[model samples]
Target: MAKIEPGNGLTSAVSRNILRGTTESLALTDGEGNSFGSDSELNAYTSERQTDKYGFIGGAQQYSEQSAENIPPEVLRQREAKWLDMLNNWDKWMAKRHKKMKLRCQKGIPPSLRGRAWLYLSGGKVKREQHKGKFEELDSQAGDPKWVDVIERDLHRQFPFHEMFVAREGHGQQDLYRVLKAYTLHRPEEGYCQAQAPIAAVLLMHMPAEDAFWGLVQICEKYLPGYYSAGLEAIQLDGEILFALLKRVSPLAHRHLKKHNMDPILYMTEWFMCAFSRTLPWASVLRVWDMFFCEGVKIIFRVGLVLLKCMLGSQDKLKTCQGQYETMELLKTIDTRYMQEGFLVREILELPVSERDIEKEHLASVRRWKETRGELHCKALPRMHGAKAIMAAEPPSRQDLRQNPTIIVELPLATKSNGEDKERKKTKEEKNGKKNSSPTPVVADLEPSKPPPPLKDTALLGSNQSLSSTEHDTYL
Candidate 1:
């Protein structure tokens, strides 16, 4: 349970600033006052920081000082084998035995297959195939200046302590910018949201930019709609729902929050908006995301409740929180013991909050909101939960299934020359007792000897990397 402090100033500062407004003063500069963008900058900065397995700077401990659970290699092998079969027959599994898929995801997606698993789980793969080359088309076009500037300022802020984002304008930052910028272009009305950067950065960690872009799209449009929109109405609704559920799960904690006038927004904005990427340890974050993508927002709600229960559920825990400041401090500095990935996940699963419960709360919250704030402005579309639901809702077509079609070239038939044919006829006649056939010189046997043309993978021609090489990706 290697619990690093959730807020090292990077996630919280950037999240708050982006929520309000972007400013020029927020740009991070190097020792010489030069803004970071070069590979040289990344090389120099990494020398000063120790990265963890997930590549977060200053997050690792020496082997002698470390005390973390290690998944046995045999267990990992078993899980990887199961994941490989699921990935190979994803459609069949999604169509038939999606319960098995859910169980596996709950257990934890293998690190190597996590990217592909996320793509499949989120339905991003189908969406990507359906809209082939759209990301590239959008990436090629000039991004909106307002969004571009804001995106650039916020780029370095996401996972700044992580190896992926440690360098200014490094490959990680560059991909994050493209994903966010292309998203702004894709949905100009929605524009850019700072919360999206960390989510996209997480996706990029598993997959490439184009896959990550679609993953972001699914998050915004399908999984958690209106969350990053103008008013963040969806998240507000979810927050209310969370508070409402807390009242049932832990009345003591709920009463404490009520007494302090602590709204869910005060703490859960980063937790829900970033999908707990900022709040949990690296392994815990990945585990949460694995379930989040598969099961949708309920996992989020469950995680929040678990935290509240652990923090202020009982009398002993609640006694220390005498006031608002105290309670908030307790929350901000979440005890590492509660954050252990295995324990946290087990608590989340056993919490017993279901989609029906969330929906019932949602309806109640909606009625309350309508009474208080009048008619809702930003209405989110009804979305399906879990991979199976998404699969059933938007079943991949044959075209979508054939994302990478193989090309097979048929070889030309060999043919004998005229001279060779004559020699063969004379030899046949001599064998039939016609001895007058002189030894006729045989022409060399001719065959179409050239090998079949090299197979061409058309999909690679328009891939994300081919659209824009890293060398040409200049930072602003």
Candidate 2:
């Protein structure tokens, strides 16, 4: 007989029986009739005593597995097989089947394959390989204190309900910190932005630390340059572009919004800033990201138009809102029934918008914004080219950042009095001689002596606070 050491105060026979999968009931005490504690107490103590050795400190369930379980097994298998083939011959597949790749992305990438797929789709793998050991270097160094506190403050607020981020020092949150901090270090000028937190958190859920970091870089530099910078010039410009597109796509909603003195930044900031992560349902957010990485920032505009149409399209629905604040409240707290992942995705896919349409509107919006602000030169903040050297050294396919010429425009100051504001705006439009023919341009009554300060708080649009997560979930 082998000598057995005491384990959790269990006797050799009891331990053996339990290990052998026998469920015989045993007394709580020794033969002396003393109490060893009740079964429930023992179980509670054992459960409480358990610690995660690997430091993940969360549920064992994989996000990919949970997301994939809804699909039919055969469908999942086929998708997995296709994904495997793409992975095996990535270069060839990307060259010949690029359109096919986009089509498949529109259908939604399989959750099981999403991790690797995002890596390939974002070209994160190539960037990661080229800049090997760069993340470790950045991670080892301390991040600037300017961004560290801000990053820490927002860490727990992101995905608090999710298992991966529930624990304060869990692997997920830690990786998120490293990635965001690394970016701050990577581009000291841009520092950090609150919107980047949820974006990085989402990425961390899908891939490892380094890959997630590079993916974030791709998004910030290529897909959304100047967005996370101190001045937020890109998002400001894009907001104007979104408003322009909205006017064309849904004239009623646009007119109603304009009539009430609502600005695009009022409701659209969160929509564009976080790439719809904080606003949309989790499942829908994932699908949107799948297409977004492959298609770039154009997906964001399409989805925003669809959302606005869904929320404020009908005259009856628009009638319910009394004022700008009420209209904004209605827009922010859209009902989930209308935002079902599959239904919403189908609507987004069916929309007749294209990148060229967005680009054309973007240029026009930039021109209008600059003209309204009475500046001929671009006054927006410059792009951070810190990673340009590394990106330039990589092959064309591996180059993560696309150097689109920055189209800069000034953000107009919010008007104060409704009556005076509308009169001034109308006068400006009439002076421009395109009031009725074109979408009402967002223009300021007075251009400030100096540019406004960099936006530090969540209130990117103006003094009004951005919608909280709870506010976002509430139905109007």
Model 2 residue 377 CA deviation in Å: 9.1
Model 1, poorest ten-residue lDDT window? 467-476
Candidates' RMSD to native: 11.3, 28.0
For model 2, state the Cα shift of residue 200 in Å: 0.4
Give the Cα-based TM-score of candidate 2 against the true structure: 0.67
In candidate 2, the residue pairs with backbone N, CA or C atoms under 3 Å apart (3 or more residues apart, or in different chains) clash, namely none
lDDT of 1 by residue, 338-400 (tens): 877878999999998998999899899899988987877677767567677777888887666
Cα lDDT of model 2 by residue, 1-476, tens digit: 01123332223432232122101112222354222233354335336534332112222211332222266878866776676567656666666777787788888887766866776677676777668788889989998987897787666656544545654455656778889999999988678877788889888777667778888987887677767664445666787788888888899888888899776766776678778876765667888899888777778888998988888888999888979778877986787655667778888888878777777877787788677754423243333221222223344452332211112336454655789888887888789775463333332221123322343444123211222211211111
lDDT measured at residue 210 in model 2 versus the true structure, 0 to 100? 78
> Backbone clashes per model, in order?
0, 0
Residue 180 in candidate 2, Cα distance off native in Å: 1.0
Q: Give lDDT: candidate 2, residue 294.
A: 77
lDDT of each: 0.73, 0.64
Worst 10 residues of 2 by lDDT: 17-26
